[model samples]
Target: MIKTNTIKSVGLKVPALTFGASGIGNLFHKLSNADAIGIAEGAIEMGWHAFDVAPHYGSSLAEIRLGLALRTLDRDEFVLSTKVGRLLMPRQESGLQNGEEFYDENPFNRVYDYSYDGIMRSYEDSIRRLGTRRIDILYVHDIGKYAHGDIPQEREYFKTLCNSGFKALEELKKSGHIKAYGIGANETEIMMEAMDYTDMDVVLLANRYNMLEPNRDEFFAKCEKRNVSVAAAAVFASGVLVKKNISEGHYEYGKVPKKVFARVVEISKVCDRHDVPIGAAAIQFPLRNKNVVSVVCGVTSIEQVRKNYEWAQWDIPECLWKELAEIGIK
Candidate 1:
């Protein structure tokens, strides 16, 4: 079984690895209901019960599929988390067009809303779709410049969140509807700024503090000081660090850049020298930081689920880490 750690602020214990539900949402390809549920069941059989999903993923398809997979299990047997942004609205057209990253999604268009009503409605909607009574963690998804870009419009959204949406999160926590609340952002600076507005128990940080880019010590220190636990997402840097050939995988949800590809090549050489799998190192690197409580990985196939579990459990020599540090990978 994977080790568990308690996010002290929320008093919620989570597994070392949380199952990311994006793949089940039909990212890049379509998946049958049986296949999606099988992936979740496979993770449960391997002793991983924590899951994270978002309304933005397949326009709520992931939440529905995950709900079906956990319908039979006892509610207290697992940890559930989902984001509260981008409420799904009915699409005018009957045909489905491929989204930015998700494919064959439900016939719904996502509207970004970060107001008080938006947060509350998003929470209730997620509950209905997930078929759950309570959610352990609720995150304000993609609220920074990374998703919205640095512009006047982005500042307006941030203002709305600070002015109105935060109240809903606090109410949820106080009313016991949710155990904790935080922001899910890819940028650290925005999260730092958010801390000034409200108290956050945890942050689902993605695409940063990973093997390919592991220079976020200052950010982690700030999180520790604020008593905010971090759940690291995109630990594989969106698959670049895990693939045997760097060219085969993507980075930051897009094609791998030349500069990033070169860095991974050097890291791979160090891994080869120590006979350690690059995927294992990438998955384990975030846990080395004291404030990071869990690493989130999305898997589609049962084989990928088994492989991720095995990789998380793989042992690496201390010398490998030392060499990685020498090469600026740590």
Candidate 2:
């Protein structure tokens, strides 16, 4: 069985591997209700009861589908989390295009609002969509320059979060509306800056602490020092680490660059020599770090869910880590 860890500050014990809900929201392909619920049920059966969802997923389809999946389960049996930032507003005249990769989703364009009122409205909306009485964790989603290409706009949003949005999260936590609150960002610098603004219990750091980009040692060290636990999201580096051929898949949600591809090739060679799947190594790498409490992976089908569970549990030789360090993945 997969293990679990406690985020002591929030008093939540989550599975070592949390299920990411993006794929169930019909990312890239349309998903039937049965298929989405079945995959989630399969993950629960396999002992992964923690799930992470967002309004941005499948044009707000992820939270709805996850709600349907967990409707019958007792609330205390699992841990649930969703992000607040993008508010889904229903349009009276419907002609909105779904998310770029999402097909056949609902008609609603997300409005990015991080004000106090916006955060409260987003939280209440998420509760309705998720069909849950309370959320265990709430994250301020995509508040970094990496997510918002405009640096000045990102800075302004960060300031808004510090000045007003953070109060809503803290109030929710204190009032028992949410157990923990933090910023869900893909970059480390902004998270460090967030620490200066507010005391967060957890941070969902995505795509940065993976096998290809293990450059956040200092960041993790600082988090440890501050007693801020981190959850690893996008641990497969978006796709390259898990794909059968590294070149066939994208990295950091886009085409892979030559320098990054070269490093992955070396890591792949070492995995081949050790008779270990690269996916197994990638899924296991973050758990070895002291600061990472959980690793979340996105899955669409039951087969993918099973494969991810198996990969997470797969055995890797200690020598592979040494070899990877030699290849510059350290």
Candidate 3:
């Protein structure tokens, strides 16, 4: 097994790589319970200590799976981060809240909720669901995008959550119930905006900084100055970086347009020049910077985890990076 390293940027020292649970929850497809647990456990055994899951993923089933896997590990060994904005509620059975009757469904089927009450409820519910004293990090998920309907009304919901969630998370940090507070979403602009409202220690950004485009320059500069660590996902661009014709919907992992594919083809040639696989280049590209401390790549199986972890071990030459830049990644 390859030993993992830690990035001591934020207040907490976390594994350089994390297992993003969105895919394992089978937002891609219904993953078997055993398979999810197996891959999650495999990540831990591989010396990875950071796990990122969100309620929006698999309709809250991702966290349930994470909690179940963590139950077997010594509590102090790992760092877990879950997002809010979409709260989880227990199924009501005969007027009684069905605590154990977990189902993966977002009640309103709404995009974002940041209400103060909703934020508190989300924190409380996550604690109950994970059966943990607290989460290491709680993010204001999808903080950038507004819901489709009711702009003013919907903004109020997110604002309430921001006001309540950040304060509550701060108190949780002080009380030792939470370790850190950050934002997690697929939006780059929103992550940068958090610097304005809150002094968070970490941010999880997906799709913004990947092999196709490295759009984190402004955020990277800010994080370096403030010591905020970034945990990136979707490095494969929803599995499009590796193969052509990726799927559509849910995180924009669809096939890179032929125009974009043109860039990747050139990138592949550059990686070929460097004598490395495109996969290896993709895995190592973001971490080349000092500001991006860790990357939480999504893994659907034990094999994918091993492949990613393996690629992470190899250091891509700076020459390859320069060559990639020449291919017009900008």
Residue 155 of model 1, lDDT score? 95
List the lowest-lDDT window of 10 residues for candidate 2.
91-100
- For each candidate in the order shown, give its overall lDDT on alpha carbons: 0.89, 0.86, 0.71
Q: Which of 1 and 3 is ahead in TM-score?
A: 1
Candidate 2 achieves a global lDDT of 0.86
lDDT by residue (tens digit), candidate 3, 13-86: 77777778886656646577788888888887877677888776666667778788888788788788888787
The TM-score of predicted model 3 comes to 0.85
Please tell me which predicted candidate would have the highest TM-score against the true structure: 1
- Give the per-residue lDDT of model 2 (tens digit) for 214-330: 878779877877788899999888877766564676677677777877777778889999999898888889988877889989998888899889988898889888888887666
lDDT of 1 by residue, 92-182 (tens): 9877645757887888988889999999999999999999999999999999899999799899999999999999999999999999989
* TM-score to native of every candidate shown: 0.97, 0.94, 0.85
Give the Å shift of residue 202 in candidate 1: 0.3
- Model 3 lDDT, full chain set: 0.71
Candidate 2 root-mean-square deviation in Å: 1.8
lDDT of candidate 3 at residue 133, scale 0 to 100? 74
* Residue 327 error, candidate 2, Å: 1.6
